[model samples]
Structures are given as structure tokens and as C-alpha cells.
Target: MVKVTFIEHDGKEHEIEAQEGLTLMEVAVKNGVPGIDADCGGACACATCHVYVDEGFKEATGEASPMEESMLDFASERQDNSRLSCQISVSKKLEGMKVKIPEFQG
Candidate 1:
């Protein structure tokens, strides 16, 4: 299992043991992590699952695809480290990784 941490805008944290193939959004939704709305249900159609990948884990999480980048254009408070959680597949490299949920979604 890959251990991941979701930190809400208010600083609430949800640490979860996630399956290897699941996306960060999937793991958050499954474990009831607040702020990850995931309205598109992993389809990458919306920005509701926006998150900021921790600087240390950026390479492991990788760059967002053009489609995801376009969708992220609709996300609120987007930053250089911002990412769509649904676009990030969890893996061993992501163990102990942390992502911060924005105060609001698109």
C-alpha cells in the first residue's frame, strides 16, 4: 500500500493507506478526505479535485497532461505545484507524499 496525506485548506489532514493503482482523488474520496470533491469521478473533466503536490514529491507525481492542464485552468487558487488529484496515480514512490487541498474547488 502507498501511504498518502491529504491536507485541507484549513490544515486538517487525512492519512490513508491507498492501493497502488488508485488515483489520489480515488483514495481521498474512498477514505472520506474532505475538500477533494472529485465531481468528474476520475474522468479529468473538471477541476473539483484540485490539489497542490508537495515540492518533495513533484517528480514522482509528474507533470499534468495537456488535458489536465486545461481543466486545471478552471481550478481556484492554482499554483505552480497545483495538480488535479484524479490525474495523479498513486504508487510506491508516493508513499508519505503530501498534497494540500485548496479552500475551494472550481
Candidate 2:
């Protein structure tokens, strides 16, 4: 399992052991982590599953696809580190990764 940390807007942290081949949004939703609404499931059609990838993990999380980039335009509190969690797939290289959930989904 890959370990991932989710930091809520209120500064709450949820450390989850996620299965490989699953998206970060899947781990968030399955583990009941708050602030990751994932309204469009893992389709990358919505930005409700938005998160800010920790700078250190940016390389592992990688850049967003065009479709994901378009969807992120709808997210609130967008940042340089912003990414749609649904677009991030879990993998060994992503172990110990951290993401911060926005205060609102927009």
C-alpha cells in the first residue's frame, strides 16, 4: 500500500494507506476523508476533488492532463500546486505524498 496524507482546509490531517492503481480521489472517498467531495467521481469532469500537492511530491504526482487542467478552472482557491485528485493515480513512487484540500469545492 502507498501511504498518503490529506490535509483538510481546517488543518486536519488524514493519513491513509491506499492501494496501488487507485486514484487519490478513490482513497479519499473510501477512507472518508473530508473536503474531497469528488462530485464527478474520478472522471476528472469536475473540480470538487481538488487538492494542492505538496511541493516535494510534485514530481511524483506529475502534471495534469489537458482535460484535468480545464476542470480545475472551476475549483476554488486555485494555486500553483493545485490538481484534481481524481487525476492522480496511486503508486509506489507516491508513497508518503501529501495533499491539501481546499476550503470549498466551488
Winner by lDDT: 1
For residues 1-106, could you state the per-residue lDDT of candidate 2 as single tens digits?
9999999989999999999999999999999999999887888888999999999999998888999889989999999999999899999999999899999995
Writing each residue's lDDT as its tens digit, candidate 1 over 2-102 gives 88989999998888999999999999999999898988899999999999999999999998899999999999999999999999998999989999999
Listed in order, each prediction's TM-score against the native is 0.98, 0.97
Candidate 1: segments with Cα more than 4 A from true spot:
none
For candidate 2, the C-alpha RMSD (Å) to the true structure equals 0.7
Q: Report lDDT (CA) for all predictions.
A: 0.94, 0.92
Backbone clash pairs for candidate 1 read none
